[model samples]
Target: MEKFPRERIRNFCIIAHVDHGKTTLSDRLLQMTGTVAENKMKEQILDSMDLERERGITIKAHPVTMIYYFPEEKEHYQLNLIDTPGHVDFSYEVSRSLSACEGALLVIDATQGIQAQTVSNAFLAEKHRLVLIPVINKIDLPTANLTLVKKQLEDSLAIPADEAIATSAKEGIGIDQIFKAIIQKIPPPPSFPDQILRALIFDSVYDPYKGVILYVRMFSGKVKKGDKILLLSSNKTYEVKEVGVFCPKMVPEEALYEGNSGYIIANIKNTAEIKIGDTLTWETGGTTTALPGFQEISPMVFSGIYPLNSSEFEKLKNAIQKLQINDPAITISPESSVALGSGFRCGFLGLLHMEIVQQRLSREYGVDIITTYPSVIYKVSLRSGKTIEVDNPAKLPDPSYIDHIAEPYVKSYLIVPSENIGEVMQLISEKRGSCESTESLGHDKVIMHCYFPLNEILVDFNDKLKSITHGYGSMDYTPDEYRISDLVKLDILVNGEPIEALSCIVHSSKAESRGRSIIHKLKERIPRHLFKIALQAAVGGKILAREDIGAIGKNVTAKCYGGDITRKRKLLEKQKEGKKRMKTFGKVDIPQDAFLEILKTDTKQS
Candidate 1:
């Protein structure tokens, strides 16, 4: 194997929709570059995370560097590959991955043409000023249509689409051409002064065995093993204990200099010490240029997370704090949830991020948790003349004390086959989404862009869209401005006690129907307690929806059963003890499933 000169290094990421062969193409790239043995290759190998491989999705951004030799000119090039999440919910993670790349490999499913996510990600690449190298993948699929995709790329992106290569990444067909296209389209690393040692920390992860592995793309100077470095983002300094380039597996090299991309392991005791988007420079600061667009990430989705066992609450908090070090997009704060007890209010980019956090908690920390329904930030103006930000439902101001509210909106894109176009439009309209424009991409595929309230789809909208389209339509969205619309905040009460945290605002017309359905669902999932429970949904202190869950009967004929009636009574006592564990939402006894099941509901009137 040969290493390309540092000057030939090209740091880029492959962006695409799920199952669009982003991972497969990444594996083929590694093979073409001789980073991984052909026979030893696995599917989605770059998705090294156990959770990601099991889910058949790339949940985290994975970094790898390979040496590819263009056979035509016999020129060797070093490629730094960042494989990013394709799901729309992880778009923020994708943005962070994009920051590390000067170019992008936009993968389009040849059979599917351009899906919603692919076009959205390509636009994101353009926003980052990344040189886009379009690659049509899965050519071997029976429905593959390379010619139309070429035309779509040309018409939609207006990029030169003359020489689009078709590939079956799984079969390694046209893999070399894809590599050649990358080298031809993506520019070589820029020259920087050797006077200063500086690099950008694009991503970081905690490894119990390796400590903190920071993914870095070097811009100037040279970094050697055992060098003391300063993390500009946190002003923390550490000695680099190990350094290596990612070659499917870490391949330790002698050194990395300007224009090379690799990972460095500092002998830091805590993984939480490393922050993504941090800059690495010499401890003895000499010169520096602030990297562009290194803003701190703010989570967009918020929820309450409590341990299934109250005693583990503190442990969950500590675990979250540790995880937040590597996961900048996740935010945690102390919160008292009526339905979840005293837990942490966690914020994430989207639902996928929330799921990743929950999975990590159980798998990595061995902690089981009861999570509240995910919510987005709500801007509230109190009557006291102070503006407040609420991420948890419990923090919502009382309807009597509230002045006005605003919720975030998102610009969404829905791509569907022409046959399902009507169904897609109908679904969007039902979600209060306004069509922005529609474009026909030849064939039967159409791209529809709409402006939708974030609150409308934050729950259940994704599943409903998939269900309606019969899995043919896919969508991606980016946060837009907060919009003030006619809305009413509905509060949930259990046994005449208001659970402020379970409150949510819905458009007035849908409030009654939604409130009734949600309350009914909650009742079905929640177990009966010793006392009868009343579930009420209130707007402006007036109840719009109500339900009652009958209490468990205490009296059982002790002598009616077997000889061990004492044991049976003891078992009933245990059942009563379990009832005490059920969380209360106002007067309702909510079982564990009530929180998660709410996210899967669809209000399409089907």
Candidate 2:
């Protein structure tokens, strides 16, 4: 493949808030460049995952190279656009994409103006020292307030309003302006061709025939076929088998050069060895000074994942390993439960990430799995002066052996209309959070910076915020320090045996109410057996709540015609004794629907 000059190659990405039409604008760019034929075009062309297309969201960063013919300049240029996800849950994806590019197109929904992620992504781009071009999209909508959006751009983001490009990506309007702006405003990729090979592994996928195929953005040098490359993170070496660029599809190139965005295929059978944020340098005489901004990601939420059928345990494990190749953000370790059998206790960035993994397992791998209740990591200070992190409630140490338990906190940034500030404040207070400060954004929108427990906002907090603000509010959060709290483990018991999968850590004040809600839902779902069943919720040795299910009695005296009263009494006494024996040995089968209901209690009732 003939290489384009580094000065004419621009590597940039699109960053925006959720539902802001970033993907649509990407489609427009691809169309305008004639990268995809008009007949072959489709919505969200880069969203290769069926799950992403069905959810109408991008879960991965997609990089593609397009050739633009400049009529005025009378030359062709390479435009490598990395399309990224806008959801805050996938901010890691956005940040990693930003690292591989020199410029970002900050797309904003004109109807909604500046959102939480809009500001959040803008800050992230600035942190990377990249040039940002603010693009106001959805201009053709009747509800789009271009004036208000431009004002927010100036007030919230401090970007000049006149510099913003107004576009309707859906109608293909103003695409030429955006196209021209890329060449005129955004700078080209920086090249260091004389340096040793240093390609950032922004993403990777598992290909059965080719082993692990890596998607990398070249930083300092070049790598060709058969060149020995080492993974700086793992200190392992492999020979490069192939090199190519994404023309929306893999087109074999002579070599991936400096400042180029492309893939490197190698004999990497073990996908785990390739870390996403790691740098790839020449195996020999490699520089120790690795690329900046690459750090290990720690998951914020943890949950137990078990195959619904125990026979699929190995299959589930294999599926998880393959999924991990795509989503390295998730952490997993072997775990077992008496009730659910062998499984993995996996950690995730958030609830949405957890849900996506579960869905992908079912969709992609055909694995039927059951996911237990989700949890956040807790800091436990032992009485012996040793500190341990507990991400699962079942693994929590006995209360007698603890000095104090501290829960993780988050500094949340919320943006909402001024009129909804009172209700939003009340909602935060309900979750045991305190407001730190508030600043006015533009004219009517207010940004509230507050602090709350990580567990408090783990589930339905954002959903509630959207509901309270009539779908106009947005939120972004960062992990804060852990603080001491009166937290306790809430255990659910059937008869006398505790169910580990149903247990969770809860604040002391909410323990009793939470226990009652679980028992109430259990009673409605549980069926009467031959023996009396007792549903109980306990904290330590104290029973906080209970529900009873009476046994299914048989009519013992119906067949005895004109039987004496003592005879009936004797029969009833015998039945009571049998029930007593059965109660001692009976096992209650908790249906899958019941577990789902208990999770609903924890997620919604909280």
Candidate 3:
């Protein structure tokens, strides 16, 4: 009902490693401010998705506006809290949230101290010039070591040990202290109301009733209902049907000014009309200058997603398009597999991202789908002097036409306990990683820097790191460069026919081993039938590995048991001849489970 001065606004985000209390802290903050009623309070109020709540992780970045009363100053301040995803897969989400805020609450688990993501996110916040408020969360646990964690924050992130706020978000302890620190420390957004209208679209969601709703942060101007707005990137104009702020839910407001974060609805019919980093301004501003958008996120993993029933293809496409309205990071293209029918070649940020997308497609859309093994994009230089990018093995060109292949590389950073350094180093080495440098972090921990092929670590590197370190290791990575390497496309053939869905591009040095493992797994998965099946792994035209599946046992000789040996031999010959004919005409029924199993196997092996 009352508008606060620009100086009384505090825009901030809570960021941390997975399961480090970001959502919990956000929930407590909402409770303290009474934005959410005590009886209505729930765990992870910002994580409205069932998947996020079930998994206890934040998948999407959520923004909420709360009013906090400052007794000392006798004033009310508008506090905007943007909660971000903690997993490395959603780092880009964290970056976008930071861009909308002036400060961030860097939460750390007191029991675990500083993890890899904590440091990585801290650097991102610093890059955006955000005021970092260090907070050690989960202090009520018996294992919480306040002194050690403070030291770790100081030694690792270079934050002042005394400046870190210690709080228990679950028990509502020290929440008032966090509020006071935010009001006194984090500065308000810069006031630029007189300037041309400019607002950043940080997030969006698709509503069946309202179409597309955009969550934005005003940086230079104000917006109101019934005003015409222009999307600078797309050069599209729409009448603002409504403008409001998120009080955990959209509440209509008369107008939204600079230094505020809220939503805008313009009757957008499709998500393709707007982009996450696009700028919005007054339709007649006559200025083409756009605000700085976020860096485009490139997908790190690729797979083929196909519906179980071919008739559901249209529904699958529509569902994916709707999902992309909210999550634009996923990349999709048309693809067809002889064994799996029509499908889309999809790209994702990471394994978790790939899994989440699959889960959402099945759970939210009620579509049963099959996914192929995940792979990374490869840069292929042909002898004809043209460089092409390939994400699917089926699209790989002939080996004779290829000059060389270059794969993506990443600068990987890992933090592990000193006792597990040897095991971690060995694991990296096995993944074809080259150590760049190593630094000691206190007496019991070490930080390692390495360069690894994107494909090599795309599958099970993180799982292996955790297993070897007994769950004490964390990792973060950034794309470094692309380097030329010896690569080959390994194809799987069943009954002398190659299955494009099972084909994969692998490094030449490990081609034989990987091919053998694939063929062996395929043999176990292909069921026994009336005809024997021959499974082969080939590179180009050369067979690298092979496996044979024997035909199902039958009682062909039962009728000739009392007869002479000649009669039995005749029956056997006839049965063998029949099997040969069946082998030529019969097709192998590859179950959907087989495709999923192969992908899971690759994760376990690679």
TM-score of 1: 0.87
> In candidate 2, how many Å is residue 464 off?
1.3
Cα deviation of 136, candidate 1, in Å:
1.0
Off by over 4 Å in 3: 552-582
lDDT of 1 by residue, 1-606 (tens): 244565577888999989898988888788777788878877778887788888889887888877777778877788888899999877777888887788898998998788889889988999889998888888898989888889999877787777567788888898877777778778877776554887888787777787778888887787778888888767888888887888767878766777777888887767557666777899885345556756566788887788888889889987888788667678777877656678888888888888889999999998888776567887888788887887766666667888888889999888877888787778788888899899887777788889998877877678887888788788898889987767777676777677654566677878788778777777888898676788887787689889988876765554456676678778777766656664342244466566657544423332
Please name the candidate that would achieve the greatest TM-score relative to the true structure: 2
lDDT of 3 by residue, 177-246 (tens): 8999999999998876467778999988889899999999988777889899999989999999998998
Instruction: State which candidate, 1 or 2, has the greater lDDT.
Output: 2
Root-mean-square deviation of candidate 2: 1.7
Candidate 2 clash figure, as a count: 0
Range of the 10 consecutive residues with the lowest summed lDDT in candidate 3: 597-606
Q: How many residue pairs clash in each candidate?
A: 9, 0, 0
lDDT of 1 at 420: 83
Per-residue lDDT of candidate 2, residues 413-449 (tens digit): 8999999999999999989899999989878999898
